[model samples]
Target: MKKEILGGLRFFLLMTVLCGGVYTLAVTGVAQLVFPHQANGSLMKEDSKVIGSSLIGQNFTDESYFHGRPSEVSQLSPYASEYKEMITERTQAIQEENGSTSAVPADLVMGSASGIDPHISVAGANYQAKRIADSRNVEIQRINDIIEANKEKDLLTGNEYINVLVVNAALNRLE
Candidate 1:
């Protein structure tokens, strides 16, 4: 009986070390080495020292800067005591105005889970082109040409997408 109990304890200890220690180190170490860009704390340093992931969306409302996709994340007015109630009231009002029972698109209605998405839909990007061009005193046609140039072509169907971060970076290059 004593020998059996000791054997069982040793087996449990061996399994724990092998599964917990070795497996975790191998997986995490390999992942960090293989994908250095996604390694801890690398993404935050890629953009301006704003301390946000460029992969996420941010709210940009100024007419001079291009706006990102609409954010669904809402904060209660400081005057309101209950933030959830405030959100409910505002959503109800929007629903009544739209006269639709369908929920808004997840991307359109609610902010991306990361709250820092930098991309916008083609339509959303186009909508802001006029405002950005007007603010910069650049020709709208030139802005349109830039947009067209940045579009990513699809391999099979030749579909194109304009990455917002890349476009904004290009805008910064414009004199």
Candidate 2:
């Protein structure tokens, strides 16, 4: 009985040290070395100031800037009635701007599964191109160029996406 109890305790300690300490350190060390930028949250900076992370979506509703998908958190407002009215008005404005009688793109009004997806479908970005172009005082062609330049394509997954935060930051840096 004594030997069995001692062996069990030894096994528990071994796992505790290996899984809890060594495994964690090894994984962290490898991540820090290999993916330092992403491991550090893929932060984007402007003028040496950290603006936002490319991996996270942000709320942008300015007439000049391209707006992201409707945030799920925004739906949790206490004033549900007012929120619905505001959203309806906002959607109407977008529809008018897009010159489309059909509904806006799903990604535009539908919050992503993560609720903070940084990338939006190319179509989603293009939907706001006109407004953003006019607001920035930059030609529409130049804005298109910026969008194409910053587009992300995954060869394996065949998924194309544009990181809104990164695109917006690049837009800010445009001469």
Candidate 3:
């Protein structure tokens, strides 16, 4: 019985080292080697200064900048009156801001679950492109070009999105 107990202890230690230490090191090394930028948080830098991460969203209320989804969306129950009211208000505000009499994109009114989703749908970006162009005093085509340049497409889902930070960063570079 004592020998059997010793064997079990050895096995446990071996597995712990292999799984916890060795396996972790291997995976981390591969990540660092192959995806260095992403492994390091996918941060965006400007003049050697860290501006933001490509993987996370930042709020931009300036009309000169393209906006992301409404970050202040309530997390209340969907059936709650407050949630409905908030959505209505956001939709109206988006319409007013974008001068669009048509339907607004759902993402513009709804908050992402993480509240840090960097990517907004192409439609959402397009909705605010006019406002951004007018505010920045740039041509609408220039804004469209920037949107196209920063657009990302998911291969599996075939969905297109644009990182707001990236777009805003590019906008900042405009003369």
The per-model lDDT (C-alpha) reads 0.62, 0.80, 0.90
35-148 per-residue lDDT for model 1 (tens digits)? 866666335433455444556655655556665654554564546767546555555643443344444322334444455666655544565577688888999887787778
**Predicted candidate 3 versus true structure: per-residue lDDT over 62-165, tens digit per residue:** 88888887666466999999999988998999899888888999998999988888879999999998998898888999999999999999999999999999
Which candidate, 1 or 3, has the higher TM-score?
Answer: 3
Give model 1's TM-score versus the native structure: 0.56
Which ranking of candidates, highest TM-score first? 3, 2, 1
> Which window of ten consecutive residues has the lowest lDDT sum in model 1?
104-113
Clashes in model 3: which pairs? none
- Give the winner by TM-score: 3
Q: Report how far off residue 6 is in candidate 1 (Å).
A: 6.2
Q: What TM-score against the true fold does each predicted structure earn?
A: 0.56, 0.77, 0.82
Candidate 1 vs candidate 3, lDDT winner: 3
Superior by lDDT: candidate 2 or candidate 3:
3
Residue 34 of model 1, lDDT score: 96
Record all residue pairs in model 1 with backbone atoms less than 3 Å apart, i.e. clashing: 56-116, 56-117, 56-118, 57-116, 57-117, 72-111
RMSD of 2: 4.6
Ranking by lDDT: 3, 2, 1
Cα lDDT of model 2 by residue, 1-175, tens digit: 9999999999999999999999999998999999999989989999999999888888877767767876574544646787667667767877887666666766776566677777787778888888788888889888788789989897999877788888888788786
RMSD of 3: 2.6
